[model samples]
Target: MATKKTSSKEAHHATLDGEDEDATHALELLAGKIGEPPRSSLQAILAGTTDADLVSVGKTILSSRIVTDAARIYRKAWDFYQEASDEQRKRLRGFSKPLLAVAVQQALALEQLDRKLAAKSTSAGVARAAHEKAAEAAQSRAIELRDQAYDALRDAAGRDEGLRAQVDAAFGTATTSETLARGLEQTAKLLRAWLGSDDEALTARLGLANLDDSYAKELATAAKDVRNAAANATNRPADGKVTQGALDRADGINVLIMGQILRAFEGAHGIDPTIPRLVPISTRRLFNRKTKKKAGEIQPPQNGNGPQPTGDGETLSDG
Candidate 1:
């Protein structure tokens, strides 16, 4: 008969069983505190890691869990610690540093990375909407100012017979020129010509109408913004999936914590059956929804400006 294979995970726990039970029990009693940690430490941690860092050292291990999975695993471990009595907490202090702290740091980093990626994914849409809104408002304002200038021209025509010829020459005798009277481009051209005209009367009429090149400039800016937004949207680098770099970092973090846990139990004895496998390896099994895969995926945000999670929102700092 072929001998049964003992998986690395099974072997790991089996090794844990050989460690000093008192140390394992002490570490198990109190968990790390929950909530967002300070930002400086987090920035250093985030910048300190990369995809290249998750290399295996001869021993193979599986670490495919997503960012949220890591966060929740830390949360669960912290939840267990939160239940400890003052005495149990004091017992935990005996160890120079509780092993779980290593896991918690990565949990926080993953939460931050998740948010950054989620924001990046939809940034293009947000910019497009903002630019479009500005363009719409600018066109409306330009048209309003154009109508005001037309009224100024009409009133000036009634007052000055000499100006009437210029008006007819520029616009028309009875009605304004359709080419010069319609659209944003037309309004801008009319404003520029009248504002910059060498004719003293034309310049005076513009002053009387309170029309200036400022409105034309605003329209120009809005038009440029729309074009820029469109280009940026096309070039944006996000696809609503966890970035490969982020996934690799997740693997690195898990491996770090797992090594710490394994070392913490080395040479000790007796199985503490209560120790959770800590986290799943890339499976969405953390929630135990078990109904179907992909159920945990989050819907895209309704608003362009605010950020939402890439995955399940059950964890607020969800990855």
Candidate 2:
């Protein structure tokens, strides 16, 4: 008589029963707080991690300030959605999927929060758009990873009865990758903000000992000349020196420093600089540099000329 062999399915089930029970209890606790779908998705990820990695991610989800921040944003979006007029909601939906009103509301919240935080730091060189873009990229990647995990769980569930409940919990009604991704992205942004350093501070730490070369002197002289030229240019300089053509030809560096640097140049001659000086330019050339680099390959410097020790810091404003 031939005996039936214990199949792989049987083996998996036999081993997973205890594991599944533990996972289920953990899922219940997380689901109560953050919803079952994302919690299940988190479980899927945690299942593949070692004890150390699992502990780390668990702390991030549970203890990070950004997680609370994201939750607040989500609550605000939900409230806004509930209060919105039907016609406005309909118009918003026409703009995009996954409920446009919620999307825009959350986006605006994220942008405002990013700006507010960056403003508190010596991050004058860091653009608000840069942080927003970083968060968006993080969200996109997190969503992609979560969907992949869900799909794998679904395929496994097709063959194993034990995994079917997990699949259901992850992909059941009202569960969307977009929601999970937003939370994941907010955590990422907060992590990035904490890890980021101010470039000017770093430079000051490194010291200017290497900047005593003739090239440095020449560069400083050139910058001063350009500043003066930009400050005095009605069309061209009276000394027949080459002034910047128009706003269209000037780069971001030129625009930021031309008027202010020119003011400092006058201060050298005992002329006190005033606020709200104007630069003459008909066209403005904005920074639109593009590259083929991957995200995280390069990061923008997080530094700028903050208030000097003598409290003589200049504030540049648009007219």
Candidate 3:
């Protein structure tokens, strides 16, 4: 019998490129042969394989045009995600700064409300005291009037016929005086009641207290929100080494502190034309003084005399 002939490499290559189905079959067969997947079996086959060089073939496939296109697309998508995340962080920081400011303002407002309530309470007390004093004065005046009216009525009761008409007038005056006294007493009672009324006092106090409480709650909520935002910002991965948002916040804080300091200095200085303006003065200069002392002296008389001089030609001096 004739010896069987094996297929040549070039014959296999031609068969592999003949049709789509044939190419796929050829690739699957090569994959089993080399234990690796093929890239475009038809192209590989047209190149004509001589040995099972799957490693070199795979490296070439990866460096080819198709993989390069896929890598470019992936890089574009990753950059877009990074940009979006950066924008989101910036927005969060922007919102957080104003929210923190609002929280501080709310706390200040609550303090102001407390002061106002205290002032109102003080005013109420002063008013009540004034009312009491007025009521007392009215009561004393009423008592005096009543006593005078009684005296007049008694005197008129002893008068003659024509004077009897005047006595009736005195009786009317006495009645008016008693009515005035009753009115004054009632006013005093009303004032005392007003000052001691628990309901009214409680209502006023509660109104102010409620306002303060509400403001405190708002401040607390805003502070919590600010803290949460700060935490999130810190926890999130930053795109750059330096955070711009943090720097902006630090600048804002510095400005605010400077403004407050200026305002405080202005307030401390009284407004007077003769008063010196605010200036930095050295402590040493503020306390420094110069002085002279006399140990002995020769005196000159008021009379115009040609001088009396020392024998040594030294003038008498004070030291």
Best by TM-score: 1
Instruction: Kindly report which residue stretches of model 3 are placed more than 4 angstroms away from their true locations once superposed.
Output: 1-95, 156-178, 181-319
Clashing pairs in 3: none
Give each model's whole-structure lDDT.
0.42, 0.30, 0.30
Instruction: Give the TM-scores of the predictions, in the order they appear.
Output: 0.35, 0.18, 0.24
> How big is the positional error of residue 295 in model 3, measured in Å on the Cα after superposition?
86
Give one digit per residue, the lDDT tens place, for model 2 in 54-138: 2211121111121222233334334444565564344332221222223222323322332333333323224344544554554
- lDDT tens digits, residues 152-184, model 1? 665644576765555445442212222223333
TM-score winner between 1 and 2, please give it: 1
| lDDT against true structure, model 3 | 0.30
TM-score of 3: 0.24
> How well does candidate 2 match the true structure in TM-score terms?
0.18
lDDT of 3 at 303: 78
lDDT of 3 at 229: 40
